[model samples]
Target chain A: MFIKIDFQSETPIYLQLRNQIIEGIAKGHFKPNDSLPSVRQLASDIGINLHTINKAYNLLKSENYIAIDRRKGATVLPLMDEPDMAFVDDLKKTLNTLIASSICKGISKDDFLTICSKIYDNFREEM
Target chain B: MFIKIDFQSETPIYLQLRNQIIEGIAKGHFKPNDSLPSVRQLASDIGINLHTINKAYNLLKSENYIAIDRRKGATVLPLMDEPDMAFVDDLKKTLNTLIASSICKGISKDDFLTICSKIYDNFREEM
Candidate 1:
């Protein structure tokens, strides 16, 4: 549930921060309405730039993952609204490419399902 | 499967081309050893830039999905080798973020698996 950033990773810093925060939510590290560290606090804690945390927070806000308030910094939102058709379509598109590649490499259907199950279960505590 | 391009889509063109080809292989539209059109020919057929087609083909080659030969141009490869740990790890990392986001949005494990099963079944022909 800790925020760890790999500066050398191919993924951009903001995305890394965003993903970890989301994962933290999924793993119940941060409950709904829990306060997140201010961007300045996180920047100092992680030794990352203030701009990077701001970007990540902004993205999370745009995606409805959090709300930015001047008094409370960023607050987690439950965000349990049903996904729209556009979300379903986008998820399908991404999974299509991933499944295609995995199939080409001979990942069995059962194996693929098992992997999905494992990852899905990893976030079960939150639900 | 037919290759269609949405120029208005936010996804880059070359990625679109590459994903479609991979989908083609997954759906049995292109079998092992099947000859894909040369980069130039595909560029002409799709009305895309030669560079875009070349980039897609190059990515396919690097991923072991196809082979490029001067004599035969590009040929579909079976690419049935079991994925290594690195590939599995990468898949886990991506799925983690996606699953986390979906969970935060109130998608259930059953719904998630059903969605995954639907997509994975889509490529059953190739397997």
Candidate 2:
């Protein structure tokens, strides 16, 4: 439920809210079936207009990231069973960029492998 | 030079273009000092309005991903020496979400580690 907004960023407020919520859900901060704060409450908490929060919620609904019900409000959706091509393509592009930057910084192959192994081990330890 | 516009997405076209260009630079598709297609050319290529392309270009310039020269045109900028905290935080958020989804799907820790090692090896081989 902790989210920060950057008013100085070029990205719009609604997008920032939408992205953070989605990222939060993905990162295990928000679990499936978890009810997010009502749009009004979230708007008040974040100090943004209710309309902006509504815009973000609307986006989440459209993206299938959340399900909206009149009585229950919004609930997190389960992750898809199979990854979409678009998602995989986007992941590949991001990894390529991240790897390129690491290499450019003189991080050797062994060191990079060590880092990924650490992340992998951390995941196993956590889950 | 080939870019497509998603007319239906909630994301604004300008932001989409800006992200794509930044991702392109990170993926090594665009080299430093490599001139991007002119704003006019890009606008035509993507079938977006000139103003929208200009907005995207303006954002890239502000982010230091590209330098616009009146006489020389827009040139790609080199990646930063060290990853910024903000960028790393953003990356963590994304990776956490992605990993959670994979785990939820029963992708074992071993399989996940294999994937990362593969990505790491690909980086070394490519570089």
Candidate 3:
């Protein structure tokens, strides 16, 4: 339930919040059906505007990472079983840029894959 | 030297242009020291403002992906030998979000690594 915000970053606060929440879920810090802090509580905890927290929640909801209800508030959703083609395409485009930059930096394919595997393994440790 | 612009994308035109150029380099469509179209020409070709193209070029220059000179216009820079920590950190963060989503989608480690290797090999074909 800890979200760190860097005010100096060029990235918007709401996007940062959303990313961290997603990362938190990936790290197993927030399991499926886990309740997130209410908008007022999170805003107070993070010392940010309530609307900013609301925006982040709405975005997460739109992406199917979480759901909000009038009686229960906001909670994490179980991971979707079906693959999202749109997300896969978007991920490939992003990976292309990172791979391009790594190539420019003289990083070999083996080394890059090693790094990716190592990072992925770190997440598995949490599970 | 063809750059396709998607007007409906949520991504900014300048950023899309920058990414496509980087991907072009990875795909060997543009090689080391290759000259890019002048800002005016590209702007006219893409039907966007000159300043947008200028912004993208400046960003590329700042990232060391390309260099701009008064006489030479803009040209791709040779790959750097040393790794950039800041860039690596940024890439790791992005990859984390991607890995998170992939895990949620039930993509296995082997599948993910296979995809990475295949994409890397595709880039190598250009060389």
Candidate 4:
């Protein structure tokens, strides 16, 4: 996968890399159990700092988005068997905050839901 | 409004203040053109640093969420005349990233949409 980093965005490079990798997972670019390129390889391939790629990978690992092996490096984790209660709580809090901002911006509830539905479907479960 | 600060959370205090005020607007606790407490007054009231409140208010100002006046201090702006295209674009990007993480966590699309619908309607338009 060609990871595009927006040099001009104010967002830190590691976070951009993190979000894109999560996006890649959602878009089925990296299937369950798929092996991601090694940190060194990805760094050289994209001209990003090795530290940046490592940070992104570590974040993904901590989030349970990926698992790292001693020798095998990084691999995508299978979807959780049950939805995590903690994760759901965090999701509600986040969505609530985002919806509040959207409401203040005059976005109708329907408009917000339409966007949510569209994005959810954009990540079709090809598993 | 009684503002609560969770120092334990990693979220910055300023952004938390910003989100709470936006939540206040959505919940109708703050009406259109409602005058917010002056920086000094709110800082004293909430026991937060004046600089933190100032940062939050300035951010709100930049987002068109509030207006600052020489005499009035700060006031909530009326809902946008029309949705800002840039804001909608940002909304899409943020939602896309969030929804991706949800999908990876075994959150079915239906479950995700239901959450969105619930949060959206939770902010009833009392205007």
RMSD of each: 2.1, 5.0, 1.4, 1.6
Estimate, for each residue in B34-98, the C-alpha lDDT of model 2 and write its tens digit: 99988888878777788898898888887677899998878988767665666556555555555
For A16-109, candidate 1 gives per-residue lDDT tens digits of 9999999998888988899999889999999988999999999999988999999989999985868767667777789889888788877877
Indicate the DockQ of the complex predicted as candidate 1.
0.70
Q: Write the per-residue lDDT of candidate 4 for residues A41-102, one digit (tens) a residue.
A: 99999897799899999999999999999889999998775789989999999999998999
What are the per-residue Cα lDDT tens digits for candidate 3 across A1-127? 6899999999999999998888788778889999999999999999999999999999999988899998788999886666688877767777887888788777788888988898889889998
Higher-lDDT candidate among 1 and 4?
A: 4
C-alpha lDDT of residue B106 in model 2: 44
Residue pairs in candidate 3 whose N, alpha carbon or C atoms collide under 3 angstroms: none
Global lDDT of model 4: 0.88
Steric clash pairs (candidate 1): none
lDDT of each: 0.87, 0.70, 0.86, 0.88
Evaluate model 2: give its TM-score: 0.60
- What TM-score would every model get versus the actual structure? 0.91, 0.60, 0.95, 0.95
> Which residue pairs in candidate 4 have backbone atoms (N, alpha carbon, C) closer than 3 angstroms, thus clashing?
none
Residue ranges of candidate 1 with Cα displaced over 4 Å:
A79-81, A125-127, B125-127
> What digit string (tens of lDDT, one per residue) describes model 1 on residues B1-127?
2789999998899999999998899888899999998888888888988999999999999988999998988999976868767667888889999989888887878888898888887778445
Contacts from the true interface found in each model, as a fraction, amount to 0.79, 0.21, 0.60, 0.80
lDDT: worst 10-residue window of model 1 chain B: B118-127
